[model samples]
Structure formats: C-alpha cells, structure tokens
Target: MTKQPESSVARPHPGALALGVLGELLITAGLVLALFVGYSLWWTDLVADARAERAGDRLRRAWAAPAAAPPGQAAPAPTYRPGADGIGFLHVPAMGRDYSVLIRLGTGSEVLDGGVAGVYREPYRAAMPWDASGNFALAAHRDGHGAKFHDLDEVGRGAAVVVETRDHWYVYRVDGTLPRASKFDTGIIAPVPEGSGYPGPGRYITLTTCTPVYSSRFRMAVWGSLVRVDPVDARRTPPPELRTS
Candidate 1:
C-alpha cells in the first residue's frame, strides 16, 4: 500500500463541537427572546391602536342617526340602548363599551373582577370629578393580553381621559401619580391627600392600578382633576382608523 500517506482521516474536534452547540443554543435562545420581545411590544402597540380605532368607531356610531328608523321604528338614542337586562354602555373614547364597566361607590378593586371598567359612585365618585373638593378616583386593569388600559401608563399628566355617558363625555387631566400606597391608606382610598389635616379641596380624579410591573403587593394610583365635561358632539366625529401597522 506504499505507507498509506498517514491515512488522512479527519476527526471531529471536541472544542469546535462544543462551541458549535453552544453557538446554536445561543442563537436559538436569542431568536426566541427576540420573538417574545417583539410580540410583547407589538401586542401592546396593537392594543393601543385598536382601542383608539374603537373609540373613533364609537363616536361614529354615536353620531350616525338611523336616517328615519325604518319608517315605523323610532330611532334610539346615541348611547347604546339599555338591554332588556338593563346594562347600558360605558363609553370612554380611550376604551370602548365592549369591555363591561361599572362605577360602584363603596365597592373596591376586588369587585372589579379582572374585567375592564371604571367606577363612578362612592369613594371614587365622592372625590373624583363630582367632588370638586377632592380627587375623583377610578381604577381599571392594564390587561397584558387584551390591552384594556395598557396605554394608561402612557397617559401623561396633561393627557385627558374622557368618561362618556349616554349623554356626554366627562374629561379629566392627569395631575399626579401615586407610585405606591400602603394597605388601607385612607389617602389612596379617599379623595383627600394623605397626612393632610383637613379634607383637601380641588376636584380630582384618581386612577389605581397594580405596581412593580407584574406583582401587586402595592397599588399604583394616578390622580387627576376634572377640567371639563363636554357634550360629545358625535357630529364632529374624527376620521376612522380602519387599519394599523
């Protein structure tokens, strides 16, 4: 065989193999993480955009009066007609009525039932919008999957949140943010400021949500005051957003 020329056989290098595997794993993990992060970002953005579109739709539907109501049928009011069960619409330009919401006074977050909503009665109502002398407080969940109030955090101190009824929209502007509040914190519960001697005046709106990103050991409350409550001129409806990128 003429000394077979050292049998030029190639053997796998252990170091290269290990490095290859690690590189593959790292690449896979990187891809997965990239996908997750992208999904999360897009999810939130989509939610915000969809809600904005729905808000505009609500305004349009509110504006459109049934040209003569099929001749015999009477036209219904702009507000979603109260169902036979009696639950009507809760309109907020930021969020549509599709999310069931109720404004209960004495009831607390526990009553919110993981659903999308806002409160108009009691503790929250006493001080919010109605209680010119105190902070009108409200709370809703920032749904991760559905995006109910996900954009709420984006609402700047100057941004306006409108709460509309069958008749009109009640607008409030962000005035302050409560990073965290202790258990049974009266200030967080009441419309007045904490540690203040007397009942604080200044009509305000307080919004409560969970804190520390995912955990709920404490409450994050954002407070604002009613600047105005204007009639929703459905006729002056803004343009529709049919699609989003």
Candidate 2:
C-alpha cells in the first residue's frame, strides 16, 4: 500500500518560544521581589519584636531583683554599660500609647534588627540619657525590624520622648525637626546638633531614621531638649507624658 505522507506538526515559532520564556522569567522575578518585601516588612518585624520582647522581659526582671551591696554600704546607683541585652527603653508618646523599644548600643543592622533603637557611638559618641549636657542621639529603623520610628513625623514640636532606665525616666520635649537631611550629616548627632536650631551645647535628644518612608535616600531627625527626669517609683508608674489620654 502506498504510504500516505505523514502530516507535519507545526513547531512553535522562535519568537513565541522566547516570549514565553521571558514571561515566565518575569513572573519568577516578580514573585521573588514580593517574597523579599514580605520578609523584610513583615517577617523581620515579627522576629525582631519577639527578640525585643524577650530582652525587655529580662531587663525588667533584672530591675525587679534587689541589688547586693556591701555589709555597710548602700546599693550603688544604676549605671549603663553596653551588654548584649539592652540598656533602656524609649517611649515616644506621640508615636502611640504603647510605643516603646529597647535601646541598645551601636547603630549597626545587627543591633537595630533586634527591634531596638541604637545609640550612636561612631563619628560622635552619643551621650547617655543621664548625661548632663550633650546630645543623646539615637537611631532606629523607619520601615522594618520593628519600625520603631515609623511615626516619627507625627512627633511635632513640644512632643514628648521619654527614655526609661533602671533608675529614672529621662523626658525630652521636641523642639526642632529636620524633615530631611543628608545621611552623612554627622553633625546632627553632635553634642550640639547642627541645623537643629540649637546655637550651642545643651542637653538634647535627637531621634533619627530613614526619611521618605521605605526609601533610605535621606535621613530625618527630631530634636528635643531635656525637659525633666522622673525617678522610678516602686510601682513603676509611667510618667505624666506617657499617661496622657
């Protein structure tokens, strides 16, 4: 029998094949980008918050424990020394009623990613909250890793920023704000921060973070003066600034 010529099946065009591959690659890339965003914005916050909570608990436990003193000597005052845990808690009432974050040493990602505000130690040594006449500069993430300063813009002039230590609550009142500053503006953390409307040295608190939301193209700072220091009572009641309705 004469063999009928087998009908040739049409092959996909090269252009169509290339387009299909490109589409698939684009989809994969989009998925990866989305996953990264989710991890950065959500997962990281969860992990950091958990770590911060544990650290905070440990700090509170330590505060509750009675200190040992020599047989005839009184217990010494609480002094801050850099440790793996933390030094204090930051309370920005303008941020929210429950806004609080542990404060640790160093502004590195390793320290900030733990969901805590970091004290600036490079370029300029940030004065501790208890210091008499220097800037207590601090940095925290604005978007992820607890986003401690996400609502920093809301902290207008006269707003309160309190730091809670083992012995005292250092209250600061917002006085100046640089909505946008160069990331390299180290002077903003100086003893008398530049461009913060301060003329000379004094007790100040500077809160800094990435500006314009998720983008880190610039930095934003909120400057404040030491308003008062309230000693911690046995009940540990929050200061008036924090108790406002």
lDDT of each: 0.51, 0.90
- What pairs collide in candidate 1? 103-119, 103-120, 105-121, 105-122, 127-135, 127-136, 128-135, 128-136, 136-204, 205-224
* Candidate 2 lDDT, 46-100, residue by residue in tens: 9999999999999999989988798999997665555375788999978988889
How many steric clashes between backbone atoms does each model show? 10, 0
The ten-residue window of minimal lDDT in model 1 covers: 79-88
Local distance difference test, candidate 1: 0.51
TM-score on alpha carbons, each prediction: 0.50, 0.94
Q: Indicate the TM-score of model 2.
A: 0.94
